[model samples]
Target: MHAIKIRLSQEELEQLENLAGAGYSLEQIAMYLDVPKNDFIAEFYDLDSFVNYHYKRGLLMVDAAAGLALAANAAGGNITAHQQLEKIRMAQFVEREKKRIIYGQETP
Candidate 1:
């Protein structure tokens, strides 16, 4: 995959850490990154790719959390209602993001 350079500051780094520590999924982080949801979905088809991509950028915590979320979404065991709920919420978030892009609310 071709990578475009995106910049982040110290404040964003701290925020990402907090979110990852709280078990936020890749989709959630992607949303926080403010890339249009549709673009994030197309580039990252699943959480695994997201983890690997982010890990290469030094997001250790987020990568590990993405791994857990991907695993839970893959296997049908040991998943709590909260994770399931977050998954659903992220799905809806992606859909809404698509809508925003379609409506031209998303900046390139």
Candidate 2:
């Protein structure tokens, strides 16, 4: 079986970038684009990277706003924000520990 070639219009590209920025999975984006997920994956070269570029671009704006909010909350002594930040840090530490154990390294 031969692979199908899909050409996206400028509007479609914009829609794709929007959907990806909204944290839609590849499968979800494929569905929105009315294409089979496997076919979309087969046709697109470096699909994840392409989507991630758009996603990160969108996140840049959000990150800036979030940073401002975080700073404001920190300044106001918001315990909830501090706790949430600590929770995120602990989660990251746990993930790193899991990776280290999986790679046969000692977890400090």
Candidate 3:
């Protein structure tokens, strides 16, 4: 089945990214866009789709912001932030190790 493509203006695309970065769900985003939820879901059925790509990019923006905040706080000697940063580092290490084990040393 062919997927329906929605043409979005640059402004709309930025709006989508901002909304996604603010942690809006797909259904909520659809409402904000004035599109039916099912249509939005159908258009963004896969990771490769532009909508989903923007969504994930938005999430990455949030991750980057949070990481920066955590690092800044840790640098300022906030004990709780330091512990949180360490936990994040450990989780990232564990994820990399799991990928290495599953995909061998060839894993990036």
Candidate 4:
């Protein structure tokens, strides 16, 4: 299958930067740039991809923010809502499994 080219232009990049600075969501920027999110959209589902893309492109704090957002969503909460649900999940899981002297669940 031929790969679909979805490149960001200088103007689009500038707009994205402006949106980010204005605290817009990734979905909003992507939508404005004509990048659709769907079941077949790999980059959209992979939060690290967005984080790394912004990080390597010199957008400070975006990567970590994206990471935290993804982690929060994975723990069953609104994505990008600034909640520490992922950390809480990890802490709870650790507390339950770590002290089980002989029944420690094997982390797969």
Q: Per-prediction TM-score, please?
A: 0.32, 0.50, 0.77, 0.35
Q: Estimate the Cα RMSD of every predicted model relative to the unseen true structure.
A: 12.1, 5.8, 2.9, 11.4
Our tally of clashes for model 4 stands at 0
- Greater lDDT among 1 and 3 belongs to 3
Superposed by TM-score, candidate 3 places the C-alpha of residue 13 at a distance from the truth, in angstroms, of 1.5
lDDT of every model, 2 decimals: 0.58, 0.66, 0.83, 0.56
The parts of candidate 2 lying over 4 Å away from their true place are 1-17, 21-23, 41-68, 103-108
Q: Model 2 reaches what TM-score against the true structure? A: 0.50
Model 4 over residues 19-108: C-alpha lDDT tens digits?
A: 665676667667777776342144434545442254234343554566666775766656544345556557767776776645765653
Model 1 TM-score on a 0 to 1 scale: 0.32
Native-referenced Cα lDDT, model 2: 0.66
Candidate 4: regions farther than 4 A off = 1-5, 38-108
Which of the numbered candidates is closest to the native, going by highest lDDT? 3
RMSD of 1: 12.1
Model 1, residue 66: distance off in Å is 19
lDDT of 1 at 84: 68
lDDT of 2 by residue, 1-108 (tens): 344455566676677767766777768878898877776665554545444455456555565567568757866899888776667668869978888988876666
How does model 4 score by TM-score? 0.35
- Which portions of model 1 show Cα errors greater than 4 Å? 37-108
lDDT of 2 at 64: 55
